[model samples]
Target: MTHGLHYTVNCSILLTDLPLLERPAAARSAGFDAVEFWWPFPEAVPSDAEVEGFVKAIEDAGVRLTGLNLAAGDMPAGDRGLVSWPGREKELRDNVDVVVEIGKRLGCRTFNALYGNRIDGVAPERQDEIAVANLAHAAHAVGTFGGQIVVEPVSGIEAYPLKTAADAVAVLDRVGADNVRLLADFYHLAVNGDDVPAVIAAHTGRVGHVQIADAPGRGAPGTGDLPLADWLGAIEAAGYAGLVGLEYKAAADPFAWLRG
Candidate 1:
């Protein structure tokens, strides 16, 4: 039913067979014309030469870089993000400049800002205060490059605050910035017990970006129990004309899901 939907591969989680710079080319080889990524560099801000090399890789691969996340802090080390942490405001603000530069270079319009996990002994209200202020800062910063900011609700994480679609919407409303919107990743929503189609039907207009992986296991479409094709149909039936990001792990030939 989602026969005509357009998709972009998130190279950060896919194409493990190749190095980071080569994944864009791999995506193009696998029939995708565009790709997205998490913050690619190990540091929040990498050197200009390093970034230019990333740009050149995408250029040489001939694929459009459509979406990118602002640095979320050592993801592998479990520091979910830096933007909302109380004393790390400087780090979060520093991250904005490079993210804006990359978006400008790639002509990318969507930027995702992940909310950091709640720090122990930090009140939720205090963290919420930090998050709102930080997101507003980011929204305006990204807007300078004509880019939109999106916040996502990641599931199975007790520490991160935005666990529902409503939670994400509240952040958007609190920031009250026209350029900020929801990420609406179906896999996360489903993992958190959301009826994906229902949520899509209700808040279609606010969904600025979408990411997908199947449920039970974060694998490609046909490898899990989610009605991915059906939900995608419903998403399209609503008004989202943006690209759906393939953000799942490469569990045994992920591209086969595309063919199926």
Candidate 2:
């Protein structure tokens, strides 16, 4: 089994809830070596200089900015995701590209691909087709920058169709790109009733990144009943040598809790 750990700065804690300027230092103080955000550069939001300064903060903090969830647009209200929206293709593509460029500037190499809401009257096979096509396009767009298009499967209210590791593998198979891989989120696995380590072991071939949170509460690593230490060991044992993002909320101050 492999024996090393690298933590990512999940935006849910490091950016989404806090102002962007405070994220990098907060992550570093929390003992994180890398950072990941769920859409850092929205078009209607900050300027290029502001975004670059954030990237500089990450570099100065000595943390590698690993990945970005590039699909926060479609889920505006509820039940929305990447492949679900019909005519937002151009906008979605643009948004994804904008973040990819920002991620490049921030020293990140992975852009997450999310499947949005379930469209009414669309067949499952058709959705798979759309997912495959969309992922292929997203992967190709990031491929030039030597970045990966990490496809994530959700199990909470966010889950629509591609909600399992096996399902995501199918999407990767269909997309047929080396740059595209599966993002196995532990909370999703637990909520979806999947055996966390087993799924990680099963998809070792295409698993690119892994995320962890408590089952039910989405709190810090050790807060849940899930056996994360062993599961983490299993993931490393199964040959997944990628970043495990701590995408959870802190019951207290994030850094204080970590230090304690």
Candidate 3:
């Protein structure tokens, strides 16, 4: 553990310099035994060969897959998620089985389900109804394998509605699924003006997973002004022992913070 916290490299965002399949080995070579990722596919359901190649890369890398995000629609195309989208329910539901199957193979029990952006022309209440229903569906699918689903509050996309821990938790409450929980991403929370320390103190029990990056710029720890170390300490003090994901944009050597 680094800094008294279990750190898992988020290969999805941090290791962009290499091809997707090569990232797990690079993270392993950097001394991280555990890794996490966003959906590493262009679509909700990838081909059988695509799935096999992804699983093989992680297996061959000798690292544990700790967390994985469910298919958040086309992320690079600014599709934050499908959970709350009006007509994309099937896409998200179809993706759940694939995510669970991959998790079963790689021993990952936590999954992040991004709440999609609010579309113009759709009533907010209507979107919320769909989100709650879809979230419950995903939760049951994962629960069958003893897995838990996490709903995250994203930053930087104004249309993406869940902006704070409270926002995400409200949705979780509505979903009313015991296995669905919050994904506390520190960078996003701070960027959206959350009370970081207080969030740790008040919601640790409800938090299923945690991720970190400095605010002002989603860069490595010290490149921005966030007191990440202190906040992580607060999380630990509050009885959170889950792996803290290093979900930042690398500015040179990503492992430099760990080494320092």
Candidate 4:
């Protein structure tokens, strides 16, 4: 049950009290050498200068950008993601290079795409088709950078179709893109009623990245009922050597939960 863990702070969710670009440095100050984030630009393709500034911030902070999310529609406003939404194909298409380019600069190889909420009046089949097409497109684009696309199953979010490893795998199958894989977030899987150990044991190879938050409150590890240390041990035991993204609501010091 012991393993070396490579932890990456999710800058988008953690260290929010500081400026967006400052979080990387803050994470470094706290002893982390790598970080990840959701899309930081409101425009999928922000000005080149803006991209430079963001990358510079990470470089200046001396933190490696390990993972990043593809543009999901205004996450602050709860758009979930537009990749599968009807009439939003253009938005998804526009972001393909934006994310991949950033990843290329940051040497990041993992990109997460959230499945948006089911839209009203949109036929399920059409939406699914669009999703598969978009996912396939992203997967191919990421593959150019030697990266992989990840689809995560969220918990307590009924609107999003992916809440189980099997569901994510099905999407991966539909896309038929070799680079697309499942994001086995223990917090989501446990809160959504899946056997965390069983899922990790079976799908270790397909889970390109891992994320964690305690169940019941989605708070920092040790704040809720999840046996996080054990779960992580299982993930490592299953042969996943990727960075584990620390994604949870932190009210105090972000590193408090991980310290002995």
Candidate 5:
């Protein structure tokens, strides 16, 4: 059975409910062999029994975990980010430990890290400095669990700080950790008015993850003008063999429509 691409999960796309025990089953039914998610444990993690069950379900389904999104605790109390968050650095570090533990349990090897918002009155250079320091700590913690940290660059309109792949690379360079890598999402590239293949080419060595959806509307790959097949080919040519995550919402059942 050929599952088109290396099927993986992005929690929000397949399972919105937290402490997801059934997600593994759902993913299996959908022909997925790997799963990923935002944060299953928000404020507090799921119980040991619950996690055991979830892990068992995944094992039963024969699916591996590709990555886990470590950017979930970044809201009011959590302060929502890894670096450039002045007062909440401690909380961020603590959260990283928790995320890393989850990854270890799931046998996952990658974590999607967000650098955080840009302060209204702060200079860009200062924000970069903060991101470098904060992400350095995060990468260290992730490494202890034998996991890799992927720095995702949000669009300037979506996030105040670190809004481009180039920006993310600069921060990663500053962090100077081999564990820190890059995460490229097509939507973010479209939002930021970027050329996907061009960015991929420029940063091939640092990229560890790739996500895709249609432009304008984040529907499945074929729904918009994303040129997904071509882009996938480009990334492949660039030497990325990691999962190309399909992180989008379908208007209907994802499998309902087919070319033949």
Candidate 6:
């Protein structure tokens, strides 16, 4: 049922019914040995105590942190990322050290860098220029710790770009960094109208990580029409040997599919 791929629970999206600090242990109790997360703090840089508590939670749970997102902007306020935004370059840069340090402590080597939404005042070309430069900077910094960066194409946000595997891969090519790779999320790709199998077949070499959730509802696997099993098989057959993150919203028990 696992399709021969390793699985990592995404604590940021899944297991949300519990407090942030408790979810790592909760994931462990649910039989997961590895987990990933979006930025767990409200801002790009958090207090030292906040950082310590976040690190302690993961350490005490004894689960390996497999992936993390650099500080994207205010997600709840509708900001998608800071990498392409003009004025927040320093914030993004400052957050890199925090992310790298956390990764170094928790054995996480993969990081997700979200592409920011388009602003009315900024030219699209200018944003692209900034995204390339910023991504390169982050890549070089994380490379010091043997960490790699991943860029994802998200759905549901019209302003946010990078909606296809090609879009993300194009940016990676522009950055021209070996450590930068595409994050193939089945849910986002399918929701954005990209051919999932075609993407895997064509871009497996550039894929650094993979995430999954059902389409139409963005729920657990069986709740939607995506042929998740078939696509996962294709991903494995295509030779992507990495953890597949379970990033989905749960209608009830998120792990019910695991029991099935």
- Off by more than 4 A, model 4: none
Top of the candidates by TM-score: 6
Would you list the C-alpha lDDT of every candidate in the order shown? 0.88, 0.73, 0.91, 0.88, 0.71, 0.94
For residues 29-132, could you state the per-residue lDDT of candidate 3 as single tens digits?
A: 99999999999999899999999999999999999999998888878778898899987888888899899899899989999999899999999999999999
Ranking by TM-score: 6, 3, 1, 4, 2, 5
Residue-by-residue lDDT tens digits, candidate 6, 177-201: 9999999999999999999999998
TM-score of 3: 0.97
The pairs that clash in candidate 2 are: 80-117, 81-116, 81-117, 82-115, 82-116
User: What order do you get sorting by lDDT, best first?
Assistant: 6, 3, 1, 4, 2, 5
Task: Please give the range of 10 consecutive residues that has the lowest summed lDDT in model 1.
Answer: 251-260
What tens-digit string does per-residue lDDT give for candidate 4 at 165-185? 998889988998879998888
- Among all windows of ten consecutive residues in candidate 2, which has the lowest summed lDDT? 71-80
Question: Over 4 Å off in model 5, which ranges?
Answer: 1-5, 15-19, 44-61, 74-80, 121-126, 256-260
Which window of ten consecutive residues has the lowest lDDT sum in model 6? 251-260
Evaluated at residue 30, the lDDT of candidate 3 is: 90
TM-score of each: 0.97, 0.88, 0.97, 0.96, 0.85, 0.98
Name model 1 segments beyond 4 Å from true: none
What value does the lDDT take at residue 117 in candidate 2?
61
Q: Which candidate is the best by lDDT?
A: 6
| Candidate 4 structure lDDT | 0.88
Name model 2 segments beyond 4 Å from true: 1-3, 14-17, 41-50, 74-76, 255-260
Candidate 3 shows a clash count of: 0
In angstroms, give how far residue 61 of model 5 lies from its true place. 4.3
